[model samples]
Target: MGKGILIHLQDVNESKKSSKLDIWLDEERENLLCDITSLVKIESVAQEEDPTSDEPFGSECKKALDQFLYISRRDKMESYNHDGYCASAIIGSSNKTKPEIGIWNHLDVVPVGSGWTYPPLKCTIKDGYVIGRGVQDNKGPAMAVHYAMKYCLQQDLIKNIRVRQILGCQEESGMRDVKHYLENEKAPNYSFVADCGFPVCCGEKGHYNVTFKSRNYFSRFKELSAGTAANMIPDEATAVLVTEQGEKTYQCRGIGGHAAFPPGSKNAIGMLAAKLKKVIGRDKNYLDLLEFLYRTASDGYGRKLGIACEDELSGKLTCNAGILKLEQGKTILSLDIRYPITVSGASIKKQLYSEADKSGFDIIKEEDDPPYYMNEKSPFVQTLMSAWKEETGQNDEPFVMGGGTYARKIPNAIGFGPGQDRDFSVLGLSEGHGNCHSADEAESVDNIQKAVKIYVNALVKLDQWVGKGMVNNENI
Candidate 1:
């Protein structure tokens, strides 16, 4: 099978010793931990952008980044900002032609979505886990990358390498802030977002935020509102039906999960609205939309519409009727769809509307994020995998993921470590007995160490890979 391009853990250890990475990392671990704790202590919530003020998520996020970069400023490092939406700090000798490597991370975190056993803002360390909201999702990795970059620059880890660390503020809701920077500024050469799991991520499915609204559908529907964000499915859906039986409250509740995996969900928004419509005398549009979505979304049909594209790595398309709202005579429903890489947004909309026309429901399109894919054998994937093997001794293969990250926003970018493989346990990654994005999110000390080492080592390999003409910059 092409000689199996996998490196063992022993080679990683020997290389670490030869490079003196372990010794240098050991000397800086305590300082790094302190910085990580401080960063996590600042609570950066995703709120509406204010044109007048500089601090949108409050000054905590901006303050944390400012303090972190203060060290760089003392060393006379290069830095820049974009409307307080984000900040990027860089350190290295002047070399523009060299492959500019970047470590991407977000500083602002999702608002504490209720259900927290401990305070979501404060960093709590108990049972060897730092319990907090941003501890795992991006804060931990952000801190780790910042410190790793700091150490690399101070120690001159890799000769003739340029590294930049970009911390994003509005990553939870949208990346318009980062988009503005890219349009107004320049893009990185080769980059890795340390926000997803390892062995590595080579692909991200297309994201479609579709809105369906029609004046005729659900004539008896009074009020409708479903989800919080386009990425999360609605756990609880509530609607008031103005039927002949008088106004009735129709409610549907389920455990909300990521929109990328919509099965097993009770579909609070869809079920409640549909059930209310059924009670008030079914509308063809309502019934058709429900049936079409259930059948097409679950893979029983609608393959021609690119709804059934599946791979051995990432699973099939996941659809969620997340948002619902009715005003005057018009009813609106927002659907969060994550289609496979093989699917296009146009094909999906055409198929959904082709069925919608028969039901008399008018479809309106909203946001669209194109699908992203990378070769599993690409240099970026190989270097990340090699670093993971060295850190954890796991020989895992790269794969695609359902959730989207900053990696997809830019070319030649993929998500690398900070999260463990399937077999490894991340006890403190979150407070909800899981890792990332969930409530009570935390980061373990041990996992942080491993993540720092992996990222640093990967950067080292990246330097060599670019020098040897292994990475293809034309894709960027």
Candidate 2:
């Protein structure tokens, strides 16, 4: 029942430089940049063990929310933190009956991991780019949403609706932050997360995190450690190989990157795991497992290890041996696999365990994300696609991606804007140049403006549904 309305700016040139709400937004750009740069200073990486019973990531993430709330309050808007979890700020017209609209963005970012020209905690502006952690992934988009909403509220341009910007603190590791918010707070009517790429992201492939445990294999080894994060391909993995002789250590080196493009960087744990067979010659079974993994990496047809799957949306299955350790004669392996949309993680795990059983390697599932897909003609896709075209005269269709985002957490969610084709080329974001989660990762100023424009237009187009009362109660 949602309707779409298109509004072309009176002067595409001037409006492109400055929309109807431009003057207010233009005045606030410097302040907006300062707020986003400040948020990037907090390290909100998810951690397993807590220094105390209190959540560390949650508290660190709260600092970001506090900074944002401070900025919003200065902008003359009411803002508050949701139980030290997510943060919300709202602005609307006198139309109290206007349907509620939500612009969701997460403040928590992936670990600043390693290898950076500048300190990950410090935001540096150079060559017209803001370089730091969380610059691209969510912080940049979060700022864009902030500016868009601020402009609407200040100019009183939004009609017949209230818009809210929700900032989640635990989106990188999981949806626990948002989950807690939903349990204690009211849900939005219509929402879109600016957490993925543009022109549009109509489909996101399934994601699964499974820990394959093998026990009674290497009891002599006292300890083993590999990766700190599941989403990042481990750059270093060390194993304390033990036998009747003594414990020998083997260290593997590589670069950590998103699993989507794993070939550019080696999986250190994977390499070390493969070398385990060579280091411990008597363990022929472990050797076979190594051979299976190597063969799968070389060719996609390795069935002896149960680590292969094929699909069209995201192409083939990608497996990263992120964590491995041998203890109490038991080998534990955590494999992060992102499968294509057509395949199920359950089926993939079944095949893997079947092979492992034959080879005497026990395996188990740790996490799984069901496949998500949407047609280009679907309302979500078309609306975002139209926004992209309105901002830029290109008609690029929605596409799928291997990397997971908050879009996977919410039903019917799609990734929109903050990345443009020119920005891709200018910033050298053309696949494997190191942008997101990489050292010196930053966002371009031009892209920031383009993103603000796109988001504002999308919000406007979504207003029709709000006006019609079709989206007010729809849980997005």
Clashes of each: 9, 6
What are the runs in model 1 whose C-alpha is more than 4 Å off? 1-43, 47-78, 217-222, 241-250, 262-266, 270-306, 421-435, 464-476
Query: RMSDs, each prediction?
Result: 4.6, 4.0
**Residue 391 miss distance in model 2 (angstroms):** 1.2
- Scored against the true structure, residue 147 in model 1 reaches a CA lDDT of 65
Residue 269 in candidate 1 has what lDDT?
Answer: 59
The lDDT per prediction is 0.66, 0.68
Candidate 2, residue 360: Cα displacement in angstroms equals 3.8
In angstroms, the error of model 1 at 395 is 1.1
> Model 1, 408-464: lDDT tens per residue?
887678888677632114343321234454556666766777777777767666665
Q: Estimate each model's TM-score.
A: 0.81, 0.84
What TM-score does candidate 2 get on C-alpha atoms?
0.84
Estimate, for each residue in 1-476, the C-alpha lDDT of model 2 and write its tens digit. 23233333222453543545556566767877888889899887755434233344556776787888888888877687787667888887556556666678888887776666666778777666777888887888899988888776766657777788888877777677777777787766555678777887766767777666664465545666666666667667776767687878878776677766565666676576577666667666666556544543332222335556666656777776656666566666666677888886788777767766755566566678786776656654666677678778886767787777766766456677676543435444423334775556778866887788877777665664455454444431
